[model samples]
Target: MSRLYVILDVFADKALAGNPLAVVLDASGLDAAAMQRIAREFNLSETVFLLPPEDEDRKARVRIFTPQRELPFAGHPTVGAAALLGLMEAMAGKGREATFEIEEAVGAIACRTVASGKRAGRATFDLPRLPQPSGAAPDAAAVAAALGLAPGDVGFEGHAPSRFDAGNAFCFVPLAGLDALARAAADPGRWRTAFGGDLGAFLYTRETADPALAFRARMLSPGIGEDPATGSAAAAFAGAVMTFDRPADGEHLLRIGQGYEMGRPSVIELGLVVRDGALSAASIGGAAVVVAEGTLFLP
Candidate 1:
């Protein structure tokens, strides 16, 4: 048996508020089945297991797993995993930031780590920008019905429900008010059938309550049932709205609050810009505190 070191809590300045992740630093000799079993045992939104880099120039390879299945790309897992690997380097007396090439099912995701504190700190990786906007958009009536609301509940007369992906798929449903956002509840089975599949859904609305706050989001994922704060889906949601909402130039920062429903309220900072009729140079960053650090004994 070997010891498996793991860390949890990402995207929150303080611990225990954001998405919880389980990171396996050394995944050598663990077959796919074994990895899946471990993931099921941990039962987080996602679990990342590390593999040796194929090339010396590269960092480490990563495999992402959900309790039910494996995901090609996930935002929190990528961030948490990269930071964990960097902390490992810091532990070994390496410099503050250590870089790694995370080879996943999607592709090689280049990760860079920066020490944020006295402890081995958070690392970051800007995943390959693969935003897919399939024209198969969802209508407002159907979206409202799914959220147990009226057709008039969706925000803005023009904006329709849309699908966007930065790697993982998401449905950006903007509501008329925080009441509708908070009252959100959908039959899991019905939602799966209605939306096709749930990588992300139904971000809570806040500006309706306080105009200064652009939006408040409550994200629902069929994979984890619910995610406190979702970075990738949040990024996709921001991109989707720009096509319809059309914010003015120079307003680069979009503030979206998520996780209110889950009791672990989270905030995601999205810096975005659209250029030449296309979204480009979108940067998503948030604070993550190490809530728990422990080792797993693989017997």
Candidate 2:
């Protein structure tokens, strides 16, 4: 069988500068095993398979996968898929902006896309579920050890180590500064001990390469090595920001820089809606560009 696939750089305005995703547009006949195999073949940070939506009103049913396993929800794939779909629609004379819903294992995600050009667009989606604290995080010392950092480098200001889950769970570790963040590397052997399981770790610092950005971050997982940009982790980090920053009730937009260490340099926009001192809603938005398109042949 042959399937149509596209390679997109998510969270970037240009080619090869953000998290690259493989999107399988014709995934009707593929099973879970086949999808996993294809994802491994692509070997990108993540891949998405678009299927017919169970609900007719929805745009599509999106299944996200890493090289290792399938995910209920993911950030880059959702954004990239929406951008591609919206751009295609516009090129077909649909409209410049589109609004739709996409189903994932986490639930239905509401998405809005604006076509920026013939091959690029920006996409924003409301998280189906808000982030929540998953459980107690490992100690700072453990986290530091897992990330190849000193104990003193583990935290800064009101931020510390924490865990949160939006659609996926992640261990959020705050670093002291850009120097600490740059020096940090994940020691896979100590990962399980630090995060208490196979949970991925999201390391961030207030110091950013771009002054306009609010934070700089890196994500390391046992399943996927280093991600260029991580929307899901950014989604989960909303919990950390609410817990530590305590922004006043209203809408707040934050730009996060990631993938710099890998030379990809991507930006993610995180929007939080605070009401009466509590988080009511959150969104992830970014631009994506379609870099390559081709047919994938499978046995």
Cα displacement (Å) at residue 44, model 2: 1.2
In order, the Cα lDDT scores of the candidates are 0.72, 0.93
Predicted structure with the largest TM-score when compared to the true one: 2
Prediction 2 TM-score vs. true = 0.97
Residues 1-299, model 1: lDDT tens digits: 76465766777666767788888878899998888998998888788898887766777888888887788877788777777777767778897777767777777777777767644356556546746784477766767777777777786546667888877778878777777787877766667655766646855454545453467888875555677878788667766667786766543766677786788866666666667655665656555556666777777
Best by lDDT: 2
Q: What total of clashing residue pairs does each candidate reach? A: 7, 0
Model 2: how large is the Cα RMSD against the reference?
Answer: 1.1
Instruction: Give per-model TM-scores.
Output: 0.87, 0.97
Candidate RMSDs in order = 2.7, 1.1
Q: Which ten residues in a row have the lowest lDDT in candidate 1?
A: 204-213
